[model samples]
Target chain A: MLSSTVENYLKSLFLLDPRGEKEVATGELAKSLEVTPGSATSMIKTLAQAGLVEHRPHYGVRLTSQGRTLAVHVVRRHRIVELFLVNVLGMDWSEVHEEAEQLEHVVSDEVITRMDDLLGHPSHDPHGDPIPSADGTLPTRTLQTLSFCNEGDNVSIARIGNQNTEFLKFAEDNGLLLGRTITIKNKNEIADSITITTHEKEVVLGLAAAGKIEVEHV
Target chain B: MLSSTVENYLKSLFLLDPRGEKEVATGELAKSLEVTPGSATSMIKTLAQAGLVEHRPHYGVRLTSQGRTLAVHVVRRHRIVELFLVNVLGMDWSEVHEEAEQLEHVVSDEVITRMDDLLGHPSHDPHGDPIPSADGTLPTRTLQTLSFCNEGDNVSIARIGNQNTEFLKFAEDNGLLLGRTITIKNKNEIADSITITTHEKEVVLGLAAAGKIEVEHV
Candidate 1:
């Protein structure tokens, strides 16, 4: 019976090591969890003692198989709940993520399964992030950030690297939504800006913002 | 913002003083919360300092108007979530109370409002317990325990005073569900049992169990 805080730490570790192949730095986990590096180290130690994580003292920490399994289930609950809140409850997509953060810890697996069935077993959430299946299978999709594409290339939005509600709203307002086709118009490397044309409308995104928007070739 | 523990304490106080007119004994509150009397007293003191309850040492404690308002909202959330779990998710009625206990503390008001609308502003839950309105107005209806009804009287089950799943399952197994009409066949006062007939089947219940079931004259 893991506390929600412990579940959250495990989730952060899972997200940081999506491929489950590398040890993540304490600083990175701290930044992702919005906690101090000292706090992250303490929590990492606790998780290691519980056999959920392995702490490589001078390096960082990585999830054990047990930790990864628990983390996947938590992610599954989060994505399924987010989809239900938006599709069934008609909640704003930008807002549902925050609500799901609290709900994912409390809803039973039975409820999540019912929600998955109700939503017709969606493969991805509204943000285009893959929902880990009940059996812990994550989707393998080849995607590149918009910042990495050639100026003349055309691509479709796949997912946003950021989950911030403000960032999501900004993308939505500019028609940078998932599955929207966009042609790269110009790239000013020195200025750190990328210009794209979507549906006869042109929008300029900062290099940092463009890097956050992942895309696939059209 | 009150922690769920504080909220639970407040809710217990509210339920113990349904009429909002009397001070409930500390021992009774302790029993209701399943805590020791000393712990109940300590918590009552904390609640009193927060201005949510008034403590009368050697007597009891009562909810302040502020406490009652918050307690009613928590009740609204609990009943609405229970109805949603059973009605929308197709969960068993006997199972939803436990699930709702966890959900009520986490679901946001926005989500609850959506559920209320989806359920068409239901006034009563599946158990016939009145759901407090969003504005905190609890329905006023006179109801009495089945143990108080006279032998030969006909009544319809209104609400079950107990939320224990086992007790509910026992009632369901005996066809003693909410809204079921039954006629009192006999009352054995010394033996502490009441016999009732429902749908041509007769069932005998001890006074303790009968007292947990509220009914209305049909």
Candidate 2:
């Protein structure tokens, strides 16, 4: 069995290069994992030796197909666990991510499958991130951020790009939840803020916050 | 945070000396943990230094009050996870022990508390083992095994003392479930077997199997 540390590394690599289209620099990997470059390089070498990754000297590293398979399973476990914590256990969506990180490595596949069944085989988690299928296939979709929506455009919240607790709490407080439809009231380029109407209430958000919220046209 | 190994040792000690009234031999601890006596002694010394156990060289060791509290919490996690797996996930009772063993080490306290509420604060798990309360209190009750019951005694299955998968599967096959009431129709001492009636069907079990089933008077 892979240690949680190894699983975390693989998952991070998958997230960094979701399409496996390019190699990720060791420095970037270290920064993402909050580990020293030396530690990341050492682990990358180990992964290379195990044929889970291909390391290019002075370039970076990319996961091998075998590594990608394992990484996607970890992602599947993580997203499924997050949804289970929120939907089944009634935990706040903002709080479930931290809990899911610890659970993803330890939860058995059987239990995860059962949870998936109980959840009616959901395609997306609470944060609107796509859940990898049981067979490790991840569905990809592109949505525009709220900041990019045109004035007077009606849209539905698709996903939250920023998952930080404070950001999620703020979004929740402002009623910016997944699948909630709202009209783009105005976009002030000079002020770098966007105004939107939800539940007959107009709310203004800074461009930075608006950019983190992905939305789909109604 | 205690490593899972440390938690396992502490939990083993608690199981071997539930009342914490007597010192347990290193050899016994080693046997229970399937580890060498040398390894057990090494860990015991470490635990002693941590003030979690009182160790006497050439004799045995026992948990301190502080150690007992931590041990009970691990037990609580294990039992709650087991019950959650069985009741919520719809897993077979005979198969959930191994899953719970891994999950108990990594699950967050908040998640476990939520699961406890979901399970309605169950006092006993699927196998009828008592679950430690959230505050580290364990309820103890004494009951007689079926082997000691007199012929014609009407009893309800309170707990299954044996947790082995094969034994539990056998019990389930014979409809010997928790809270199931059965009549002790006969005890053949010479044959070393006991005959019980459940659901108007007479089933015979070896004396050893009967000894592992704890029951209470109906």
Candidate 3:
């Protein structure tokens, strides 16, 4: 009977350490979840006691394999629901993330599977995030952020690292989307902005914005 | 900010008195929600304090207009989700009721409206229960339990009063579905059994089972 709050914690931990490589500092998790340091510590202790997380005194915490499984399932539900909301309901991709956050916790696994099948087993959600497989594995795709691409490089957008609705809307408005080919025209290091051409339209994106858009070299 | 448990309580209250009529006894609500009388009394007090319900000590409780509005919305979500699960997802009708119970509390109003439109504004769910309109009005249809119908009366199944999965499955298997016209064959009052003929098939239903099937004179 994991509450949605607990599920959110597990998902956040998985997102912070996708490969389960190392311990994630408490302060880092606190920042990620936007909770106070005190609250994060208490919650980490609770998770550790439940065997969902491993905690070290004065160090950091990491998810156990049991916790990872639950987190992946939550991610699976979220992506499937997001795709369903956008594809089936004709909702805007910008608005589906918040709706999926609430629904992912309550929709039965049966419903998620139905949605997955209905959407033809989509590998990516509307936001370009991989939908975890039913068996709890995520599809891997190597990509670099637009900010890291060299000037004059040609790349195809592979994913959007941010789920912020406003940012996503901005990206969509400027023709930044998964699979769109873009040619880096200029990189101004001091101004922290990069210039790119997509389908002959020149667009200038700030460092923050460019970093949020991951791309694969073409 | 009401929890799903609180929403369930409000929904139970609305079901106990859909018309917002006279006060509903605490014991009746307790029975409907399968909670103990003491718990029901405490919950009613909490609701009364929150102004969603008016509790008359030793008398009963009744929903305020604010509460009724919220409850109606919950009911609307429940029926819409149930219909969506069955019609769109091709899920079993017997299983959808339970799924809708959890979803009704969490699905966003936007999602519900999309479902309502996708379903082409269905008036009733698969179980033959009326779906409350968005503005909190229910379409009225007079109906009575099959147990109350006289022998030799011709009736059309209007709705199923009980949402029990096993009973609903049995009713479905026996062709006791909404809008199905059947002729009363015989009634054995002492044995508490009633016989009906639908199409060319004759079926005998127990008093309890018959009571759960609502019908209208054809």
Per-residue lDDT of candidate 3, residues B91-156 (tens digit): 988899999998998888999999999999999999888999998889888899999988889999
Interface RMSD, model 2, angstroms: 0.7
Against the correct fold, how does model 3 do in TM-score? 0.96
| DockQ for all candidate structures vs. native | 0.86, 0.88, 0.87
Candidate 3 per-residue lDDT, tens place, A1-218, comes to: 79998999999999999999989999999999999999999999999999999999788999999999999999999999999999999998889989999998999999999999999999999878899999998999888889999898999998988889999898888888779999999999999999999995889999888998999988
Residues forming the 10-long window of minimal summed lDDT in candidate 2 chain A: A134-143
Regions of candidate 3 where Cα sits further than 4 Å from its true position: none
Best by DockQ: 2
Which lDDT value does model 3 have at A150? 88
Deviation from native of the Cα of residue A55 in model 3, angstroms: 1.3
Q: What is the lDDT of residue A195 in candidate 3?
A: 98
Total colliding residue pairs, candidate 3: 0
Q: Who wins the lDDT comparison?
A: 2
lDDT of 1 at A83: 88
**Model 2 Cα displacement at A191 (Å)?**
4.6
Structure candidate 2, residue pairs in collision? none
Instruction: Put the candidates in TM-score order, highest first.
Output: 3, 1, 2
Docking class of 1: high
Q: Compute the lDDT of residue B142 as modeled in candidate 3.
A: 87
Per-residue lDDT tens digits for candidate 2, residues B1-218, read 99999999999999898999899999999998999999999999999999999999998999999999999999999999999999999999998988888888989999999999999999998988899998988888789999999899999999997768998898898999999999999999999999999985788999999999999998
User: Relative to the true structure, how large is the alpha-carbon lDDT of every model?
Assistant: 0.92, 0.93, 0.92
Q: What TM value does model 1 have?
A: 0.95
